[model samples]
Target: MNRERIIAIVAQARAGQATDEELQELADALDRDADGSVTSAMEESLQQGRQQIALPGREKADRMLADILETGQVLEDPGEEAETPAVIAPLKPGWKRYGRAVAAAAAILLLAGATYFLLRQSPRPEEAPVAGTNPLAPAAEGLPAGKKAVLTLANGATVMLDEQHNDTITRQGNTSIVKKEDGRLAYQPGNAAATGLALRNKVSTPRGGQYQVDLADGSRVWLNAASSLLFPVDFSGHERVVELDGEAYFEVAPDNSRPFMVKAGQTTVQVLGTHFSVSAYSDETLQKTTLLEGKIKVLAGNTGYQLQPGQQVVFDKIRAGSKLVPQANTEEAVAWKNGYFQFSGADATVLLREISRWYNIEVVFNGIPAGYELSGKIDRSIRLSSIVTALREGGVHCTLEDNRLIVNK
Candidate 1:
């Protein structure tokens, strides 16, 4: 049960020379000696020793054995194989006699491949971060304005509005607008002249918060968290057209002459007067247009399909045939707008990203764990620690450091 006996037994096990009975005895002694703090340590040590023996060369195995014996961290006894060649120990006056040899062995292991592997496999120490700061916590500071607006035209030219970061940019006719330096374009509508150039106007919400906008022709738009909208600065002569790159809900102004159109990626959703949600983030493989009211037509590539109220159409480039699939829970699709991460079994990466955005933290994984689907609702206003605690309860261990979330298995 003492360290010396443990080390001798472990050495024999590593050499692939220990008998079954001897291995069992070693395990018993280790179990008695190691408390709960080292539950997996003995097992890990055994595995590493076995790996060293199994490696192609005898020299490599000896180096591994030396490394283990010297560390004093390895289990004294690892159950089983013990065919280790006898090692000559110099005359030792006392415990100090082993110290110099152990140091030399450590240096030798560094020269061998085992040390390289161990260094690579070792878990990095967590960096000191802002204490008690939860990545998922809601910002104590109120809404922070997002990025600059870049208006794109059908001709492919782009115009940057509010380039100066001035709080007050332009006052035209009855429109009073403010452009904060943070790239947030805040507008107040007023009477507008017909001579003003009509182009698609877009506003994107960054990581912090969401915004709502009313289009020129009375259409109402709710831009969800981390989403953006593109509409006309003023309605043109024909149909009202705009583009979307993220999640947004629209209550279109019904004008048969000026049908509201949403352009998302390769697909276009045309609605006369309907409520629908479009999620077209570039990271997502599928573009979804979910109708909540009235009717809408989704056109992708060469085909066009009509969607009924309460129906969702999904288009994917990777899958063959029609990609549209109905979602059982439509509320989850629009949860971001409502201020929560409404996941009904979402993948880890996507789920983590949402958590990161809400908490304003980075994420790093120790391993590529299996994709686990979890269904839950989290308030965006809550602290990051609260969310991480919930995940830990769900069987995932994570720690926070340097504004980053690190997962450990």
Candidate 2:
């Protein structure tokens, strides 16, 4: 298909003047172009026959799309529709044509009244990102993070939580899956058999995504990007055990009679009830468990280490060797959970890696400069360019190209 022509048609749709055929054609274009790339993942599987079963909140999608097609109006919010009249302005003759405009239109289907897509490719930032990079004249943006995650049921079916879904998602045994307004997935337990074969459900956060889950045992787990948690539908055995592959902050429910345990990589943390966080990503070299309150035992190989409040245990998962640090920066260790990147002279590579995971972008380094470090507190909700600006301010030169951020010494 002529991509430019489709973009033009989508531009009309944004102004509320596209025909029903045009809208359907845009939908078809999006359906055929899911190559496991592109940022508008919310609308990718609509045509992949993945919608065999109706989604919880999908009944109104067709109607909404049809209404916009029939009448030139955008529904910005429920009970709050915006009247956007058409604006006619001609671009310069040599303006570069990009198909991201079409993807932006497709993103609007999932995000009603959305004017622009979040992850659209933009030009490499000049010395000044705000003044020189924006070709379409976007406002000064500090992009705040939103609810983003995926839920995998025991059957292997995956649900993208950031897209369309209703109050109640599913019923697994005695637990009811609920999608919260802020994009958190919670499991509510009913009076079902507490002791039986455990049916496990896993929730995973992609790169540049995070989510919170209320486990069946009344424990709350806040998951960082590139992390997954597997737990049963409800508490069954003498102990509650959940497996973690990435990073998570846990406020374990206190049941002294039945201990709660978290298995992350080669390390296991056993606690009756406590507030703590575990960072154990496979890509990272070290796994650190920081305790906030109460005492817990951490086991690595044959050695066992006990932790108290404000103490953290750092261990090399490969070597099975562990060390404990007192007066841990419990705040800095958990800045991600609190919606910030708190750094205190962190290494340059480490900072960039964390940025890559949170923003869902890749980082390519020109050279790793030794003895380079950065310190600051950056809001996780800010735009990619904002971070790039911060890095530049810290004497690390960088530029954003498409989905990858390139850094230079």
Q: What is the C-alpha RMSD of each candidate to the true structure, in Å?
A: 21.1, 18.0
**Prediction 1 global C-alpha lDDT:** 0.55
User: How many residue pairs clash (N, CA or C atoms closer than 3 angstroms) in each of the candidate models, in the order given?
Assistant: 18, 5
lDDT, candidate 2, at 390: 43
How high is each candidate's TM-score?
0.56, 0.65
In candidate 1, what residue range of length 10 has the lowest lDDT sum? 113-122
Cα lDDT tens digits for candidate 1, 1-409: 5545544555554554555465555534433432422223433454556655354444444544444444532212222232221111111122223432333322222222212110101223334433675534443222222333453433455445535455655543345445545544554566555445654446765655566666657787777556777766667567878888777888887899987889988789998998888887776676778888898999876677888766777777677234555543566677676555665435666777666655556678887436454443444554555556445434555666656778754
Worst window of 10 by summed lDDT in candidate 2: 85-94
Please report, in order, the local distance difference test score of every candidate based on alpha carbons: 0.55, 0.66
Q: After superposition, how far is residue 134 of candidate 1 from its true place, in Å?
A: 11
Residue 395 miss distance in model 1 (angstroms): 1.3
| Local error of candidate 2 at residue 281 (angstroms) | 1.0
lDDT per residue as tens, model 2, 1-409: 4555564554554444667577556555544544423223322333321335544443344344433333322232222233221111111111123234333343444333322211111223335444455321233232435567888887888888888476999888778999877767788888756548678989888887888999988899999988999988788789999999999999998998989999998789999999999999998878999999898999865568899999998888677688889889888888899766665546768877888888777788888745554443444655666556445543455667667777765
TM-score for candidate 1, residues paired by index: 0.56
